[model samples]
Target: MTDEQIREYFEKVDKNINESGYHLTNVFATAETPSFCYSTGIFKSFNIPEIFISSLPPGLCSEIIENYVEAFKESKEAKRNQRLDFLTERFPVYLIDVPVPSLKEYVLSSIKIYGDEEYKYLQVIYPDTKGNFPNDAGYDYDQEIMGEFNN
Candidate 1:
């Protein structure tokens, strides 16, 4: 999108954040990447790291993220590299730190909307059908689904 379009989009996102304490942004998958969704105001509202989830449908991502935000508001903060069983029962999910480099690539929208301030983020990593994470011994799912965070 053009710069102007992006600006307008974030203006709306800012309004949403102001009204509801957060906004969810979903980026559809391309041939070389997987679908992803992230929250934009968790840090601002709860003074905690914002959440990101990849390789999930937009609706499911929204559900999981919303649940996470609610839990966080209740003082249940998810720690880095910890398994988060409360978000899902189908398979456990882990929260990994999203490094500065990966943040520029994956969660740019959040950066753009929130400005150049240092923002902490935790990626929600879900396992494959056999319960294997991207870093597991027998992870069979496409690694792209986890984005570049693992690298």
Candidate 2:
């Protein structure tokens, strides 16, 4: 498919998430393109982009709806500009959420709970096992395996 067609395919995902009350706001997805591609590939395996629903805080939901509603309320020309801004600007990406969701509990899950006191919360949702990530890099490089020629 042409780039436009490929882009068109991604549009469905955007539309579904938007309509589902999911905004694009969360910790930035800094996963390398290769790892991201790999993870998204795993997500696809679980029929998530279609069946996997997420959860959202009510406040965030209202914020997203207000912004979307305000944008669409503008006059035709303004509407076009608003849409352009949304698509072109790097807006915060909030994962779309399903009303009530359940996660298969894991010992070390993606949803890490961290806080001092009072302000505690479950983390952003995550995909299953194949999508699991390690805590830190532990591998050591061998100089014999990588000479200047490796570069």
Candidate 3:
């Protein structure tokens, strides 16, 4: 989809969530575990840092993974540059990151796109953060990794 289409899609989703009174991030939720993430860089174009890392041509995931793992833990300004460096090494036919709302939806979308009659390879990794939401999410941010910050 073009950038305009993407924007429209997001706007629709945003409106639905607002009317439903759900968290903006919860746009991905549907029943079961709503906290899963999917790698769609192989399918279509989307934007995010991960899109670049996951969509490499071939034999590049290993190198990308090594560099990306480091990026997550690094603090230097150079880390972002390194992230971009490893990502552009192999451009998937498409983009970098695509966020789906749930595990089932993510899987179904992939199957529809990549199955024999139907499943393509989509890798999903769900990260769990063991912290409660701040009393005021409207504050714009939260604690980092550990400790307790009120944002």
Each model's TM-score?
0.83, 0.20, 0.23
Candidate maximizing lDDT? 1
- Could you give candidate 3's per-residue lDDT for residues 78-104 as a string of tens digits? 222111334334431112222332234
lDDT of 2 by residue, 3-120 (tens): 8986774565355444552223222123331111101111112222211212333344344434433443343112210112341122332222222123222201112211121111
User: Residues 1-151, candidate 1, lDDT per residue (tens digit)?
Assistant: 8989988998988898999888898988898787878889888877778887777888878778777787777674666566778876566777777765665777877787668776778788888889887767888875344333341
Better of 2 and 3 by TM-score: 3
TM-score of 2: 0.20
The candidate that wins on TM-score is: 1
lDDT of all predictions, in order shown? Answer: 0.76, 0.26, 0.30
lDDT score for residue 50 of model 3: 26
Models ranked on lDDT: 1, 3, 2
Kindly report which residue stretches of model 3 are placed more than 4 angstroms away from their true locations once superposed. Answer: 1-27, 41-105, 117-151
Instruction: State which candidate, 1 or 3, has the greater TM-score.
Output: 1
Model 2: pairs clashing at backbone N, Cα or C within 3 Å: 22-96, 23-94, 24-92, 24-93, 24-94, 25-93, 25-94, 54-97, 54-98
lDDT of 2: 0.26
lDDT of 3: 0.30
